[model samples]
Target chain A: MDRKGILLVVSGFSGAGKGTLMKELVSRYDNYALSISATTRSPREGEVDGREYFFRTKEEFEQMIADEALIEHACYVGNYYGTPRAYVEEQLALGRDVILEIEIQGALQIKKRFPDTLLLFVSTPDAETLKNRLIGRGTESLDVVEKRLSRASEEAEGIENYDYFIINDDLDTCVTQVHQIIQGEHSRVSRNLELINTIKKDISKFQKG
Target chain B: MDRKGILLVVSGFSGAGKGTLMKELVSRYDNYALSISATTRSPREGEVDGREYFFRTKEEFEQMIADEALIEHACYVGNYYGTPRAYVEEQLALGRDVILEIEIQGALQIKKRFPDTLLLFVSTPDAETLKNRLIGRGTESLDVVEKRLSRASEEAEGIENYDYFIINDDLDTCVTQVHQIIQGEHSRVSRNLELINTIKKDISKFQKG
Candidate 1:
């Protein structure tokens, strides 16, 4: 069956290696498309429209809100950022799985609007590992690392809401697990309604001589 | 993280090759245990207790019902049969995935009683293929074959309720797909609560100091 694409929402604590995992997944697999959020903030030099983001004026972003075109939108640092529903629907129709990497609030909002969306939570197996990844790999100060760790504690409360968990202990294995999960989602009964309906019709028409 | 086993309910139309697929799976994999149903029917010459079935008296079966020890039970041809909850729970706690090969009604009953059960429906890709297999492989009368086909039509109505469809286009591929799906189910957030909770607790304990 040619199944529809999955709306996958991936959330993770900072320094959990989600960036590396997603990079490997997209580099190795051609079927996934990363989502670009519509933001009211201006794009920096060399950032292309629709590729980096759908840059919108504050007024235009609020208008999208009024028109109910965004899947889930949130404000950060006095700027509006949201997922564009049309782009997501268009990619899904083309049979490309849309990947949305967002924080917990936006992820929950997307789940409320689209109940079948598969939510995945990624994290290092322990907070100690997360802390090492943040400080050991970066030039960030102790204060910044502590701030991110605090935010991680808050995010942990919502991990139960996701449908799957990807612990980034090994990059290749984590990527493989995520890919297998999304692949398996295609076979889910709720997602394969078209195939199921066709088979049911065929069974109904079958007659014995 | 190690996780508990899945209650896998498998059903299919007659001559769908589910029996062959299951045989191949069990022979090739050691992680799965086929469920042994408790039945009031008299055992055949070679059938043994606790292997083929847990032979029980009709009175004992009724007692089990009263004790709420059976997950699901049904009567056929004046004989009572049921899945013993104790056996299933024991095997699952040992981390062995239990397989239940049953018809639509029993499958649905198991799903209702165990909401986390993974329901799988298998079939040949076409009704004509199923018809050919039933006739070519057996000496059953046309009447019997027709009866099975009629039953299949009725069963098709409930196929949509299953979690996945295993199209038996190729035996090895079908077995591999089933294994992959069951393996993938191990990563589901609903199944790994212990790991999720442990991570959540660890994050909470990580202090900003």
Candidate 2:
């Protein structure tokens, strides 16, 4: 039926492996597309524009915010990061389920803008695993890790607001569960109005003939 | 997590293959139990109580009704039929999803009683297919087939009220989709409050320690 794709807003704790899950989800499923974000932060190393992110000048990012071109935007670590409305809309129009992996603020903003948007909170089964993952990465300083853990505590309050809680205890299982949740939503009576209307009309014909 | 089971109210047109789908679903999955209905109608040959249907006397049925024992009840074809509240409650308490396959009137009544109940309406792809399925059974007369198609038209109006519209065009696929929908519901934030609270408390400990 060439149905329009779902607007999925995924948020999680900083060390919850949400990014890895999103990467594997898209890589495994041909029907999904990971949304690209626009950021004023300079691209690191080989991260290319429109791939890792749409690297924009601070002026450009501010203009997008002013023009309301971003679905949700926030300033983090002295740089403005936002989801590009155009790319997401185009991919959704093409019937590709777009996944926006952002924080709770942006996730809630997207939900407010698009009520049909599916809000998913990704996390580990417990905070111990989350903290361990952060420390195990061995890339960030202890202070940075501690700050992220603190942020996670605050984020926990918003987890209840999401539609689904995806515990990334196992990568493959979490991705499959996320995929199923999206697929199941497509059958929701509210989203399938066109099919419902078609069936209604189809049944009316039977009554007449 | 000792999560409580969902009260799943399933309804569909007369020939929607809901019964077969429910059978396959339970057979294929271990988590579901089809609710047995109490009836004053004489048990058909080989039908046993507590199996096919719970055979009851009209006096017993009326007394149960007076006691408000049935979740919902109605008279059909000169016989009384009802869903027993005690059995459904027991199954749900055991963490087994209870499926009540009834018509629009009963389904709506169950919804009103249990606001958290998940309502699923099953149907074929179109009215023509519905009619074909009814006729293809090679049991019902032309008169009965015509009557069912008419009833289906009226039921289509209530399809919108359901939470999900399950198109049973293919038996195996429909069963799988239904299973997925129910499984997905287990991860819904509202359904997993214990997990949410656990995660919340777990993360708070990280902040303090």
Most accurate candidate by TM-score: 2
User: What lDDT tens digits, residue by residue, belong to model 2 across residues B1-209?
Assistant: 32689888888987899888988898998989899889998875667898878899999999999999998998754678899998899999999988988888888888898888999999888888898889997676788788778878888999888999878888988888888788778789888888889889878976744
The worst-scoring run of ten residues by lDDT in candidate 1 chain B lies at: B75-84
**Candidate 1 lDDT tens digits, B1-209:** 44688889888987898877887888898889888788998876767898778999988999999999888888744578788788789889999999977778788888887899999999888788888998986656688777778778788888878998878889998887788778778888888888888988989976445
Which parts of model 2 are misplaced by more than 4 Å? A41-51, A55-57, A66-69, A205-209, B41-49, B206-209
- TM-scores of chain A, one for each prediction: 0.82, 0.91
TM-score of each: 0.81, 0.90
Per-candidate iRMSD:
1.9, 1.8
What global local distance difference test value does model 1 have?
0.83
Estimate every model's Cα lDDT from 0 to 1.
0.83, 0.86
- Among residues 3 or more apart in sequence or in different chains, the pairs in candidate 2 whose N, CA or C atoms overlap within 3 Å are none
